[model samples]
Target chain A: MSCAKPLSWETLVDWWAADLDEAGTSSVEEHLLGCDVCSAVARRVAATAEALRSMVPPVVRPEQLAEMFRRGVRILENPIAPGQTCDFHFPKNADLAVHVLGGLALAPGASVEVTLRSLASGTVLGHVEDAPFDAQRGAVYLACQRDYAQLDHDLVAEVRVGKDRPAARYTILHHW
Target chain B: MLSASDTVVPSRWYRLGSMMTEATDSALLAAIAAGGAGRREAERALCRRYAPRIRLYGLRHLRDEDRGRDLVQTVLLGVLEASREGRVREPEQLVRFVLGTCRNAVLRLRELEGRAQPATDEVLVAAAGGEAPRDPVNAAVLLRCLGSLGDRARRVLELSFHEELESEEVATRLALSRGNVRVIRHRALAALRACLDAPARGAA
Candidate 1:
């Protein structure tokens, strides 16, 4: 059964601190949006939480914060070029695989050039001259055998689908 | 509000790349003012640079971790919206603009909470007025008080906040009864509050 009672201040603080499960958090958020009394309590609790957090500044690292920002920005910044989109999932015990997504219209065996470049300097880091499309996935894979330790900088993959098609650039953010 | 799962393609990666290098505060501001992909990239770069600081502000004022994150989103979006709408007069003074936004955000939060005045610690240091009360708590004093707590108390706080573990999980790990865990957490926070709000150690 769902909790009918107003959540205690401690529970509210815990929710605010993200010390709750996803379901608990969602329920609390939904309740807070509607309950004025709880909202007021949360504001005060938030002040206390802030004080405690400020006292412990190192709780969240700079890189973690940057990564969160990067993720949030990804939501705001739309991909300008037209192509299929796919998420990057690194598999253990496999070569570094960069999936360059292309439009669904791209047929199987469609030739493409995948050029990886440094985001900061625009210097070419690697290139695959003739990677064919996996039409099922509508993407091209650029497998790199270099030591993973050597790939730490933010990069962009410029994928030219065909001779006349516009090159679609994909951001490859390096997460630590 | 594009979910990463929904749109995996790069919308503004090139701009993100170029903006990473040689973009001054003014140049970033200009990019934000230009709108579209330029604006999005600038927003990303700015968030990456300032979100931590803003989160700290949220923690100090809002006193909640989730609220601190919300504060980052609120402040950044507000600043970007203001910039995009051509409201920022001094594009070069981006730092000042951000500080002002933060101040306004804190002040607005107070208003929302029905507080007619700023919280004691939130007294505007730059305001021209009578003596502002010393903040009830300072980081150094709080840290010192935190260290004074027993190891168990410290661990509970760490596990609860840093590890983001539930009380039940924390109890399981610590081998304490769930009820005892709650008691310890309550007593620990109370002790900390009392210590932090206490008068300076040697004030005559």
Candidate 2:
């Protein structure tokens, strides 16, 4: 609070990002340690960062999936082509169940969407708009807690690109 | 962002603190030095205000949560002991003391890891010192806020924070420029903070 010109959110975020050069880092910490105003902002941002790190979204990126594997987390990946009904049996060691909806011809500049629905109850398990799609690989990935899907009912992942209707629907029949 | 060029510091600040209304840091330091009945309470008060900053410092610099917690305990203990022995001449400079202790402790830790790594004079040290009283964010609220973001923003944060990816790596994975990634990532986090701060304001 002693600072007349306090650090902005952008600067604090940059600090939170921790990607700044050495000088940038020093400047931020120098001001942060001295300026109570900036310290308050940085604290909230840091807490949010802590929460974000612990969070596992329904969707994940390739690097995230890879990191999970590196951490020794077991994953059961079911690669299903469009309109294919894949029978997935989650191994006892599996922590995550991934459904890769492949074979979608994503046109350039297309906004991809993914929906995970329960086949029996018609419950929408999850939905992601602006899903990150691999245009070159022609695929979209949907992941969920493996233990949650150990049931008699089937689960289906539908993928759509810049369209109201799904271009690809891959069904997952979970066999515990 | 305050670059290395923005060096108009008021003082070498170690006074960045919380729980300010109850007592001044100098008072707390004086209490500990006197070793009266309130000495233990004063030490706890001081630690409560500064432990979060030190823990955060340990986490980012040492790159380990356990190490961060370790650093907080170690540094606070040093502060407490030094205060009791009247070794700390300037109670006002505890912030500087804590920050310096963290660096020293970290250096000792590095030495223990086998031969000191090159002190490449990296920014990791300063960036990690960002501190505030530890606040527990509501998990349900955070998830709800997270659910509001676009998939790209959420993925960006996941990769950056959880996966511990550099901006360059995240940019490469998402096919975004490094600057773009930083902007998007912070904006999402800022919104989350705003949302969390909103209800607290109303309640308060």
Candidate 3:
């Protein structure tokens, strides 16, 4: 039989986010202990959250990046200065494949975009338009998971802002 | 549209809940605490009911799969011991008792993991979680789902989980109200669930 008393997804998310209070927590646990159906739903929500938790977006803020370090997520940080080139070797069991594009003179409050394109064939590997800027270092951090990293090809970060010319460019060589 | 039916439940749980002779939580506790011929059976039933719940608690608090499994066994053993010793303060409120035990266990675990002085007197909020299997969501499929998310949804998730930020911090960072963040996260999670539930194009 289906669960007669099902908790809402919003409640489950709040529970996962630690947003629920004492009464809410008890109610969920009580429901879970009694209703197998609701328990199953809660599991899916958790699994989905876990999947997202382990993933590294195309771009992340410095604090988010540091949180990965705190979580022991192995990151292969490729810091390449604009107009400079460095190779990438995605080590085994790597979680984050980051390319820190440094030495940009972006105007404050300007939206940064990093369009990754292959150097040899000029094919666009991926276009990550949402970038987090480090105003102090004048850098833009661009990243994705290790699975998205292509091997044995030099690529360029065609950095730009909305409807503007290239602000800066960084090159990444291939390795591993 | 995301409801309890959105994902497939393990058959074992269904069997546990559907058994005709199943007793209520209070009855199970009374039997276990009363101590007699029906005690073992009651304890087994109790474990069947709450093992998954406690494991989920461990997953949320401890954040490790092995630890989650450990918690299921540990809590079951603790409950059994508590029943045998007649130490269950409120047999009627066994859910709270179990939850309290789970919290204490997590605090002890944190202490062992080098985070000194687990809070003994702190009033903890009851934050329940879900049963996490060894292989949960398919990573590749989930990545596709995440990629299909809108910028705002994706950013909300990133802020919530990636940065481990609370609702207020996430709201401040994303420039959305806390209520808005919750709604977006809920909708985005439902969307991801839909994508995850759909048959993979390449799957046979």
Candidate 4:
């Protein structure tokens, strides 16, 4: 059997994986009948693509969103131990409002910084530093403005242990 | 004039032009330009339309859901600020701008953590696919084939397929003409098909 061109075996595999139409299927059938190397490459690519498609993570939940907000509020209200990081998840379309409560473990005169960043574009939405931290009642009150609400990206709130490293990172969904 | 069934299908470019007409981005841009009530409505529409896609894109890049969401919010605000300043004129431009920003953000995070090789292709493949191939040898071959694509082509494929953007939207955001976008997309798809079908041809 004569082939039109000596298409590389690798190229053929790429074509087969991408092609879903009749022409592509027929071409593959013809190639398989005439070439052994191409057939193996095709099978491998298909299997791998299939395997990769299955690993996407499931969606976030409301409870996770509430917890993430609560944790962010906590970190902003109290000082966290250096090197300790918290991860909080946000559910889609949940309110962005958060309330901080006072806790006895927080130290007096400790300041909190709330930095909101986008996970998609890695942009900083808002960064408020030296926000008053009241250790007395173990609570600080702060409101997430709608200014950050227009974003279509996922948000990450990083509460630094001090001025250096993060004490906790909370994910919040911005819904307008 | 032709009957509906007999009429030639509109070209991708034509479809894209029409899509652009109703695009939320365009409306947002107009609202931003107009200011006031129109601006508020456009901004809201922008948030509704792009937020989920942005979140998903962020998740894919950052591998952390919370971080991705935060990034989406920040990018949107930045876009709004730029719009307010008359810096951005087109909604399609926002997509590229956001993705470019995302790339930078991920790089910064990696640097801050001092982690070399942020994440492996295997991890992305796994994240994209799920459970590692039951057969390691076959998986390795597949990875090699995907790696063969040039970075630009790979990115185009991801933006078109993974991001689920229409061809015209992809073209507009990428600043390419619609025809060019279709061609590139076609070539990329062809490449993927070739890579997958190579084994069968070899066997022949």
Candidate 5:
């Protein structure tokens, strides 16, 4: 598989398209990395592949991650119901706000408690006690400060309503 | 709709938010293989850099957009996982590594689908080699070259490459023999390559 001499056009094309086995591909790639002539051919083959790809309509839609981003923006537009669980999915290190729709119904003077936990390991990634709640807007808020590394897996945001009410859970779905 | 130039880059590709834009593939792979906080960032950067091309390769072979999407995720995830385990080597030959993984992904897909025959990966074989054509043939020059081709030849290329139809289907649709279809395509591509390699019209 060591391409001593320049590889044939067919072999280069195969290399470009990854048609060769590991050893053959490695040989061709090693040569292309150092050989100007072969590298130039590899570039051209890539260009042709790019051209052919243009002819085909996109089978896969654009990343939904962008849409999720916009959703973060629109989350404020619609108020979460009193008991509605707001689901937020985003990558780590994102400056995201947990939107609890319709706000929570707190006891006489009980404050809202928001906690971000890893669903996989049951680790508490972030916590906020007696979090600032807008009673007029019936909403509670917490800043999502978990490390992106912590977000490599699934996560959940739990809101505790005092000591007796059911907690509203928001599943964090991140695509990165 | 289809105005001449046939290059299709994935949309919004520049928004990958990579911090290692200046890092070489070797460096990125090294970081990935080293295993640390930087590994995740490097893996993300590498995936962003190559996912579009890998997806395009899948689309061409699998002929289904969803399957193509699957190929992209599968291959990239495999690379990240493999690199973590010290399975990937020779980071300098990064392109080949990605391509090799892509081929394996396609073959696996083919097997899963129970395709009776092996998929041919040489559709562009005829365009290979020869005094390495201009690294990236000028778009205007390429369009002019494609425009200069005879109608039937152009149509043949359109049907074959653009439409991605099989040779038999292209022949049936164009009312030409399969051999005739291939000849026209080969000749047309040659002409395009020559035009691309030639100096711009006003060059000294």
Candidate 6:
């Protein structure tokens, strides 16, 4: 309760809450252990800190996120050209989510659908809704949610449309 | 469309590391403010450093790894977007901005999850030290003490501890005189101690 700088228990509380450096924090801890008033203050401060932290949710790793950004940039730079078909294999452990950004030219009536079919059992996961293709900067954003946590199976994405038959297939390598 | 020119990777990625290493925080802020390639590079670097922390913070709050990861990604993306839009003014304010955004995101997630009570206090205490005191009764009493403080005092305390803001900044932002801030902060602490000391306070 009594300090040189007219400091109060709140100051100690604040110090404890803020995760201050060792020196300041240690001093605050010392005070809390010795002074009943400060100890009480520390308890409240600690509680408040806990409450605030709980209110916030957890977030993902930076490396994984950086990879996602890199993928986005890659898609923007080199999309599937009109006549070229590229096949990508989703690993059994990977749940891929693709986003297709429609280009300017595919405005009127050009449509594209990406179907994911299991090669072994011919089981269909689902079809991704695609917009009309544009000449300027059309893109198909594709994301596959593979149940890697469950079964290990190779899934192929079949690109189907009228007249343009540039088909590509990828083998899913299941890790888990 | 698939020519070599289109395939050529931008030289910006190679330059990014050096720029990040050499640039001051202010310089990075300036580059971000300028927008274009420089902004992208700056954002990438920022994401690299702070994203992990954000994820860890999120994990502590959400208690779900996948959800936490999503929140981290969302927070970084939001920060990048804000930077692109010229909403962020100072580089030093980045932590505050990220933390505030994370707080809001968690609140929304809680609403979606239908969990009313937020465990921020418990999270903070655990984060502060590896081991909390073994006495649950005392811990509960302490929490009650914190609840007794007024909103402003609580805010100041939370900001000071959780966000690690300096007292001077807290006073300035809260528009309170430094002396008054100090006094209120002190009183709040004292009141908490009194509450903790009272018999059966934890039960209450």
The DockQ-based CAPRI class assigned to model 6 is incorrect
Output the number of the DockQ-best candidate. Answer: 3
Tens-place lDDT digits, model 5, residues A1-176:
23357766656545544446778865765555445455555556555644644431111111222344575632222235543344445433444334443456654456667766777888875555555455554555433322332333456667776757688776655443
Candidate with more favorable, higher DockQ: 1 or 6 = 6
Segments in model 4 whose C-alpha atoms lie over 4 Å from true places: A1-176, B1-24, B89-92, B113-204
Per-residue error for A80 in candidate 3, Å, reads 5.3
Span of 10 residues, lowest total lDDT, candidate 4 chain B: B125-134
Please identify which of the two predictions, 1 or 4, would achieve the higher TM-score against the true structure.
Answer: 1
lDDT of 2 by residue, A64-131 (tens): 77888999888888788988898777787777777777888876568988877779988775687777
Q: List the residue pairs that clash in candidate 3.
A: none
Predicted complexes: DockQ each: 0.03, 0.26, 0.33, 0.02, 0.04, 0.05
For model 5, residues B44-100, the per-residue Cα lDDT tens digits are 666655655555456446755556666766767777777777777777766777777
lDDT of model 5, residue B203: 23
| CA-only RMSD, every prediction | 24.8, 12.3, 9.3, 23.1, 24.3, 25.2
**Which residue pairs overlap in candidate 1's backbone?**
A46-B62, A46-B63, A47-B62, A49-B63, A50-B59, A50-B63, A78-B11, A79-B10, A79-B11, A80-B11
Model 2 RMSD in angstroms: 12.3
Candidate 3 residue lDDT tens string, B1-204: 755655445554455445413787777777777887667666766776777777767777777766676666656677778877878877777777888778787787777873323222111101112334324555445555676788789779877865678989999988999999999998998888788778364121
Q: TM-scores for chain A, candidates in order?
A: 0.42, 0.63, 0.66, 0.37, 0.40, 0.33
Off by over 4 Å in 6: A1-176, B1-13, B114-204
Tens digit per residue, CA lDDT, model 1, A30-103: 45533445555565555444455433221222243345456552212112234333344344544223333445
lDDT of candidate 4 over A2-91, digit per residue (tens): 345544544443343343355654455444433334434444443333333321111112344345567553222222332333232333
Q: Can you write out model 6's per-residue Cα lDDT over B1-204, one digit (the tens) per residue? A: 576655555554566767774565556667777887676567656665554455545544565555665566666666767876778766666666766777788787777874333333332223223322212333234434555667687666655544557677878988997667666665665565566557364344
Model 5 DockQ reads 0.04
Each candidate structure's TM-score, on Cα atoms with residue i matched to residue i, is 0.31, 0.60, 0.68, 0.27, 0.37, 0.30
